[model samples]
Target: MAGVSRYLAQSIVGTLRQDPTLNPLATLRAWPNLPAEALKRLNQADLSLVDRALEQGGWIWEPTDYPDNLREMESPPLCLFGRGDASALSTPMVAIVGTRKASSYGLAVAEFFGKGLAEQGFIVLSGGALGIDAQAHKGALAAGGRTVAVMGTGPDVAYPAVHKGMFAQMEASGGARVSPFPFGTPSFPSNFPARNPLIAGLAQAVVLVEAPAQSGALQTVAAALDLGRDVFVVPGPITSPAFRGSHGLIRDGATLVEHPMQVVEALGGGMIQPLPPEEGDDLSETQQAILACLNGGPMLTEAIVRQTGLSAPLVLAELTMMELDGIVKKGRDGYQRGL
Candidate 1:
């Protein structure tokens, strides 16, 4: 029986390798249940191939029996490839996913949630897509924490060519890239919806930063609810199409999240202390003056000079310090108080 299970697992993987769109669920469901299916799938592959490709890439298994909750679903994937530590999946995980074309506001939320979640020891799960997904992964990485990048493509295939560097960085940082797809599969639109389920399922809750009505991130929210996970939507400018979907989700009963700590509390971590706002709290006099100039909002260099009453060289030095302190935000427009 064990041998048969291994054969099935191997065959499924091999088939998917050649064509990821092959009905993996069909093949999986045929195997009595997910556990037996996973065992067979693994046995079908070369031991070395499985070892090398998935050593740290998590597992594809079914629970021994239908977990009552999961079994009640329409048709759960026969098996799933869990990257990183599965135990981490069971921990308080928050899925921070949003638009691939995100606004600065979206980026800020992703970073804030990533850092806050990591600091509180909760794992962050997200697709490894560019934009918001990348920002979320980066946020967690920047905080020296573990995150999981669930892939729509193969773990070995970095979907956006440019993110190869980011992908390598993620693996190097004790984070893991995961996918239900086998090695070397190119990304497909269909695969993304398939991948969304895992991202939503693995997390205790889902956080939508900025998603357009048609965005794939919203699909993740649907999956989260189906999996019985909590869903939180960050409200954004109602006028922005980027926020349309999130607002709709909120109207439909998704929780609203104004801060990362809200997500932390939702996951049972309770309220969190934001790293003390150090801008004014620990600033040198010079730094304070620069901030004072920018506090009115974005300012031109000349405007800053007039406001601070400081020489160009002096103002530049102070502004640099304030920038380094994260007290000021910089952009093409000019500098402003870091929101």
Candidate 2:
């Protein structure tokens, strides 16, 4: 099996070099000489160190284990290198992507979506970058849910360095850190555009929290669109440049989403189980009134106040407390019942 795996790896590498745009599996099956030529190249290289590194990092490839969602891509990666529980890939996934220079609003929205989706049994997926990506992963982790980080660098390489701890926690928590790049690959700007598709491909839907007109998150959105994956964009303040790309996407017909459940519903809500009710059966009268106001859908604090005849300050205070207690969630549109 080891020898067969190495031969298969060589064949994929050689085919990629010949035509980077071609599907390697198809090429390998169609051209009999492809494997021989690949093996020849492999003979000339030293792979002992690579094997050692893979073993040390707990990296392995299970070609057959590629997620069904990703396999539908026009050009999915020939193989994936992953550390930790790859089973997480089989779960319903939603990718959250945004600018590395995210604002507080962007970070909060990303985290809220991440946590809410996780609570509903969806695996949150994202690039392992700073700003929004980091916050998304943190939110999922806080919820004690799995989250996969699709990386541009090698599976073993932590690109931002600051996210090294987060990556470690992901692996420990039965989530995965995955990359299609070869071992020892460094973080390069050129690698990220290529990496974006994998992030989009792994998810049933993609969400853009915040992105500038030129943000790399747009690349992922394009890939998602090409693959026919549902694309959702959070509306940002018109004055903020960080949301320019997201607004453009909405204008181009992408679904405009304010709450995470909006995303779940757009993707067909059957995949996720309903979240259990919040603890503490005894609810305050104001809390009951607020919940009553939100029965139709999400409502703003002011709207809830008007319907419940509560003061603005009291409504705001209760909403904040409820959000922390998992009784409610705040989105761009307003406050809604939590998962």
Candidate with top TM-score is 2
- Using all chains and alpha carbons, the TM-scores for the candidates as numbered come to 0.68, 0.69
| lDDT score, candidate 1, position 8 | 59
Global lDDT scores for all candidate models:
0.72, 0.80
Question: How accurate locally is residue 53 in candidate 1, as Cα lDDT from 0 to 100?
Answer: 58
Tens digit of per-residue lDDT, candidate 2, span 235-255: 888999999999999999999
Q: Which stretches of candidate 1 lie over 4 Å from their true place?
A: 1-74, 82-87, 280-292, 295-339
Instruction: For each of the candidates, give the backbone clash count.
Output: 11, 0
Clash number for model 2? 0
lDDT of 1: 0.72
In model 2, which runs have C-alpha deviations exceeding 4 angstroms? 1-49, 270-339
Candidate 1 residue-wise lDDT, 94-188, digit = tens: 78999999876677677767876887887788998888888888878877877888898767777898888887777776676767666555666
Ten-residue stretch with the least lDDT total in model 2: 1-10
User: Residue 242 in model 2: shift from native, Å?
Assistant: 0.6
